[model samples]
Target: MVKGIPVSFGVGIARAVCLSAKETQAVHVDSQPANVEQELKKLHDSIERSTAELNRLHEQVSQEIGAAEAAILDAHLAFLQDPAFAGEMKTQIQEQQLYAVQAVQQVMEHFAAIFESLDDSYMRERAADVRDVGKRMIKNINNPEGDAQEAYTEPFVLVAEDVTPSDTISLPRQLVRAIVAAKGGATSHAAILARSLGIPAVMGAGPELLTQTANGDLVIVDGTSGSIHINPDEETLARYQKQAERERAEMEQLEKLRDLPAQTTDGRRIELVANIGRPEETEAVLAKGAEGVGLFRSEFLFMDREQLPTEEEQFAAYRDAISGMAGKPVIIRTLDVGGDKHLPYLDMPKEENPFLGWRAIRISLDRIDLFKEQLRAILRASAFGKALIMFPMISHVEQIRRAKGLVEEVKQELRQEGIAFDEAIPLGIMIEIPAACLIADALAAEVDFFSIGTNDLVQYTLAVDRMNERLSDLYSYFHPAVLRLIQQVIDASHRNGIWTGMCGEMAADPLAAPLLLGMGLDEFSCNANSLPRVKEQIRRMSYESAQEVAKNALALSTPDEVKTYLASL
Candidate 1:
């Protein structure tokens, strides 16, 4: 058995099919100075062909899946068009007299390394994107007619050192039962695409996967538990075969609930929503039966670019989301850039304790110009549909008041300019800081709603760095203190006649569902893939039972005790 990070949830049993690592590995090829111009031309032509391929893949993925998943190809296209990326390769070929393939390999590896070294996990996953583009460019350079597609005659588990987004998307979905990679994390584009495509996937399994597993070896991939069993004993195989069938049945049952309301047996209806980063994701969100979008991460618009997004650009993105939801409320979180999430264009100072330093609401407050631009754009977009504003990492009531003041200023400016917008649009703040949780009541009075960002809340409440692998056990949403803080925020919101929603991993957790429901959480927002399962869990229990579970859970002494208690239910 091998342990890995589970990116997509499911169970699969199939014969192993190992993808050759040599296909992705770059080979060095030295060229002569006289052939530099020719090498450069080859490089340019390869990029053009890669661009066309990505464009076709983007359209294909958009049609097969949704626009959000297809958007992953946009990064590949961006890299192909990026002067910095192509120009670096051109320079390598011209100055170092290297072949186009070698230039691509070297320059891409250099960029991928820079991304891998970043403090941010999301940015680190981008290293895969860089390497993926390089592979495509190399392939196009070698075979301009395009390499023949691999034809799979039987269903098999795809084992690779790592799979790229393009490769994952281009795969024959019906024949690929699951994917097990020795590299990659949950945030990699490949993982994201797998989840979007509803395929079982286990990533970051380490190098042992390729070494130990052979082609035609029977493999059991328990993606939910991140366990891989290679040529398992008869007893283990039988147990997993049963589990796989159960998983399939459960998936079919969940699909039936997609169009149903997320209501408990006792008739309490919870607003089930999805957390999305881009406008294109709205299609996936709605397809999963999300009542609305609880968190539209506006920071994505400000990232992977050379400059701040103009008001019109921001407005267009927000408008697209609002329009896509077709009047379902869309809560747009303001620019929460700082800490691990850095923008190259923004002049932010490095801090020793970045998480505790200038970040989120702090940055927005300090940079009034950037804040108002986003607010104005959001407000203008509000006129098209039900749009709300949310501020993240607020430690006190002052931050909420100050942020609200700027929103008012934007509203006034829009009014003066005679622009149409929803004057009564709701305002909300993310209760992620321990300080904010303690003063929930005070903060609750200032905002129309509260969305607890438990990812950071768990970190701040326990003083645990969530990104630290060594301390992962200490970083849990099931922690007693974390649960109490969440309860406190929910209670405070209800007391003030405002609703509370959670847009974090905890919200999607089936084990945490009953406890949150019993705590009277008004809304549940998670990734689109988890919506059906979460809703199914809610539909299975009565509100009274969930409340009882919550009561028992709150009395628990430790995270394990709480989890054990929830599991027993």
Candidate 2:
């Protein structure tokens, strides 16, 4: 068995099918100067054809999936139209006397390497797009007729060095049984797509697997265990088959609770919602019986672009999510980029500690124009459905007041322009910083509600960067201090007569459910796939018992002590 990172949670056994990235054709330098004009024409024509193909795929994907996922193609389309990019390639061909295809390959590598070297994970992932576009151009020039469309007649485990966003969107879900990638993390686009589709995936399996495994070999991928078994014996296959059957049965049991309310055995009601990044995910959330969207990551609209998103573009994306939810509350978090999520267009200065530096609300507060654009967009979207705006990384009462002040300014501007909006819309703040938790009472009075972003709250509380793999053991969400802070935030919100919800990784854990529910958390938001299991967990216990467990957990000194106490309940 080979160990790998478990990106998506599931188990699958299938025949392996290895996929290799297209290699650039070798180009020999000309002995004499080639006609520069002829090379330029050929390069221009290839770019046009590539743009047209991308446009066609974009429309098809938008119709089949949603526009949010289709927007991945937009980055490629923009690259094709970029004069600087074209000029660089043209210069390489003309000045270096290299073939058009070689010039494209060289330029793409140069730019892609820069992106890969960035500290931000989001920017690093974009390097894949650079390579993808270059491959498309080279393929277009080499095979102008476009080879026949590829199809899979049977289910197979897909093995690749790395999976790009475009590849994830284009593949037929039914034909791909599972994914084993040599590269990628849990937060990568390929992993996100696999989880959304309920496919088992093991990423970062190492390059050696790609070299050792042959196509058509039987393999078992256990996403839960983060292990792969190659060419298992009959007895081993039978054991895995049984395990897969158990997983299916467990899923069926969870689905039975989908239509039921997320109420305790003693009849205490709690709202269970889903956290989504795009408008398209609302369908899955609704299918899993989510009452509303606890968190809509609005920063996704600004990513993978060279310029800031226009107000109209943001409005349309926001409106699509609001309309899709069909009156269910959609709490959109405004522009939480910084730290691990850096945008290519933003001119943010490098910081020694970016997570604690200029990020989220700090950036928005400094760039009021950017903040105003997002506020205006959310305001316009509110007219269509139940929309609430949330501010992230806010630590002080002054920040909340300042942000609310800007909200008022945008509202008045829209009202003067005669644009209809929901004037009574609720605004909220995320309780992530330690400073915010210590004074939750003061901050609670300023906003309509509070959402605990425990992902950051845990990191900040433990002084461990969650992104740092070396500190993984220290970054425990179940740490006593994190729980104490959560209890404090919830209690503070209740004292102020406002509802509070948790939209973080902790809210999704089944073991953490009892502690949170007992702490009187008004709402719980998690990934759509985890919604049913969480709802089922909520239905199984009495509020009184959960309260006892939470009370005991708070007294524990260590994370292990708290976990042991919670597990016993």
Candidate 3:
């Protein structure tokens, strides 16, 4: 058995089929023609062909899996359409006199190397996308009329060194039962695509497993535990088969809990919501029985574009999410465009510590015109349904006051223009930075609600850089200090007559459900797929018992102690 990082959550048993990029021979590029314009035209044509193919794949994946998986193709499409990237290729053809294919290969290698060198795992996986696009372009150049689809007849688990977004979308779904990758993490595009497709995946399985197993070997993938058993014994196979059956049955049972209130056995009700990235994902969120949207990331509208999204464009997307929920609260977080998420036109400086640098509300405050446009859109969307505004990475009472001032300014402008809006829209701030947590009481008095963004809160509190693989051991949600801070945030918010919710990865964890419940969190927002399970966990535990668990956990000094105490519950 080999251990790796669990990306998608599921289990499968199947014969393994090894896939390696190295196995595919490099395409030969004919020498550059004397006519540079002809080579440039060839490059443009290849890009167009690759984009058309990607669009087809996007639709195919959306129909088969979900819109989120298909959205991965959107990023690819953006890269293909990026003028700067294409311009670089044109430069290589014009100045270096390289063939169109050779220029593509050279640019692909150059940019892929740069991406792979990044500290962030998500950013690093982008390198795979560069290669994927390059591969498509080369194929089109090599044989424009050739078939793009690669077929495999038999059903098996796919084992690859690295699974790209395009690779996942293009794979024969019926023939691939599971995916075991030697590289990637939960946040990688490959993993996101797998989860959207409901395919079990184990990422970062390391290089040894690739060497130990041969093609067609019997492989058992336990994605929930991030373990892969190669050529398991008969007894092991039987156990895994039973385990898979149990998992299937449990998922079916969990679906029955969808409509039920996320109430404790003691009759305390908890709000269960979803964190969505795009407006297109609202249907999936609703289908998962989310009562509302806890975090509607507005950055999606701003990303992957050459220019800023217009107020009308923003309104349409936000309106879809708000109206789709049918009066359920939608907490729209304003554009959070720094710290790993960059826009082409933003031209943000290269900060030494982006996470702590000018990001989130900082960017918004600095660019009031941009901030006002989004606020106007949110206010306009609020007229359709329950819409609330939430600021990310807020740290000071003054920042909240300043942001609220802008909200009022926009409201006045809309009122003067006789534009309809939700004048009573609730405003809130994300408790991410430690300074915000410590001063929660002061900040709480200024806002209507508090949503703990534990993903960042934990990292900041524990002084651990989660993107660093070596620091994985230290970057834990179970840390006592982090839990203590969470307790403080919840307690402070409640004291100020405001409810506190968590819209982070921690809220989705079933094991942490009791901890959060005991912390007295008013709302639990997680990924849509995790809603049923988290709600089920809440239903099984009594609020009083959860309180006791929290009380005991707070007394613990170490993460292991808190973890052990929680496990005993």
Candidate 4:
């Protein structure tokens, strides 16, 4: 059995179909091409062919899956049209006298290497996109007749070093029961596509996965637990088969509770919402029975592109999300860039400790013009539906004042321009920093609501890097210190007449649901996939019992104690 990170949840049992990485590797040509013009023409023709193919794929994905999933292809298309990308290949073909295919391979690999060197994980994943496009163009140039799509006569588990976004979309959904990759994270475009398509996936299983597993080998994929078993014993296989059936039964049961309120047996209600990055993701949020959107990660719009998204572009994206929610409150967190999310277009300096250094609200405050543009877009989108603006990583009261001041300025400008907007759109801040939680009352008074970003709050409080695999055990949201801070923030919000919502991974956890509910957390926001189960858990217990659970949990000395106690209940 091999362990990996679970990206999508489901159980898959099938024969392993290991996809070789050799095909995607760059092949250099030793001899220079005699005809430079002809080589350039081949490169240009390949780009055009790849572009047309991508267009067809975009339409097919939109019809079969969703517009949001299909939008990834648009980014690929942008790369094809990008001067830096194509022009760099042209330079290699002409000056270096490299063959068109060889130039595409070399240039794409060079760019992918640069992306992989970046500190940010999200930016590094983009290296796959660069390679994906290059592979498409290479295939186009070599086989103009078009390569035949791989057909599967039986369901199988796709084992690869890493599955690209295009490959993920192009796979026959019925035949590919699960995906087990040697590399990738949950946020990778391929993983996101898998989740949207409801396929089970376990990524980053390490190099051993490729070496040990062979085609036709029986594989059991427990995506929920990130476990992969190759050629399991009969007894083990039977147990997994039973577990899979049980999971299917539980899913059917959860579906019945979709329209039900996330209310305790004693009639205490909590708002269950979803965190979305793009407008099209609102479809999954609503489908999962989210009462509203708790956190709209607007930073995604800024990343994976050449330049900052214009005000009109930002406004259209925000507007579409608001419209999709259909009057349900949508909280849009403004531009939380820097620290793991780097924008190449933005000339940010290299930082020693990025998380502690220039990031989030600090960057926004320094670049007020950029801040104001995002504010204008959010406010403009508010005119269409219920839109609320939230600022991230605020530690001091001055940051809140400065950010709110900008919002007011944008509102005034919109008013003078005869634009319609929600004048009373609720403004809020993410209570992530330890300083923010300590003075939550002061911060709460300045905003309509507070959303506890536990992911950062835990890391900052424990002085642990959440991304460090070695320190993962130390970075627990269930730690007494983290819980105390969460309780403090919620208590302060109530004291200041503002409600507090939690938009973090902890919100989706069933173990934490009872404690959070008991703490009087007004809202619980998480990934769309986890919503139904969270709601179901809340509905089963009494408010009084949850309160008692919270009291006991707060008294616990360690994270393990808290988790153990919660599990017992």
TM-score of 2: 0.81
Models 1 onward score TM values of: 0.87, 0.81, 0.89, 0.83
Model 3 ranges with Cα > 4 A deviation? 22-25, 28-45, 56-75, 87-101, 115-126, 139-154, 172-175, 555-569
lDDT of 4 at 435: 92
* Candidates arranged by TM-score, highest first: 3, 1, 4, 2
List the global CA lDDT of all models: 0.86, 0.83, 0.84, 0.86
Clashing pairs in 1: none
Q: With candidate 3 superimposed using the best TM-score fit, by how many Å does residue 287's alpha carbon deviate from the native?
A: 1.5
* Model 1: lDDT of residue 394: 87
Question: What value does the lDDT take at residue 288 in candidate 4?
Answer: 84
Report the CA-based lDDT of candidate 3 relative to the real structure: 0.84
Determine the C-alpha RMSD for candidate 1 after optimal superposition of all C-alphas: 3.4
**Per-residue CA lDDT of candidate 4, range 1-569, in tens?**
99988778789999998875444444555564547998888888989988988988887866555554666776688789889999999999889888888889989999999988987544565687899999988877766676545557899999988888888888888788899998876667787788767789998899999988999999999887789999999999999999889978988999999999999999998999998877887887888899999998898788767899999999999999999999999999999877766777899888767788888899999999999999999999999999999999999999999998999999999999999999999999999999999989889889999999998898899988776544555878999999999999999999989999999879977778999998889999987777887898899999999989999999999998998899798
lDDT of 1 by residue, 1-569 (tens): 99998878788889998886554455545444538888888888998888888888987876665555666776778788889999999988878888888889899999999988987554666787788899888877776665645668899999988888887988888888899999876656787788877789998899999899999999999887789999999999999999889988998899999999999998999999998877888887788899999998888788657899999999999999999999899999998877667776788886767788888989889889888888999999999999999999988777888888888898899999999999999999998988888999999889899999988898888987765544555778988889898989999899999999999878977778999999999999987888998998899999999999999999999998997888688
Which prediction has the highest TM-score against the true structure? 3
| lDDT (Cα, 0-100) at 206 in candidate 4 | 95
Q: Which candidate is the best by lDDT?
A: 4
Residue-pair clashes per candidate: 0, 0, 0, 0
For each of the candidates, the C-alpha root-mean-square deviation to the true structure, in angstroms, is 3.4, 4.3, 3.2, 4.0
Model 3, span 265-291: residue lDDT tens: 999999999988777777878888999
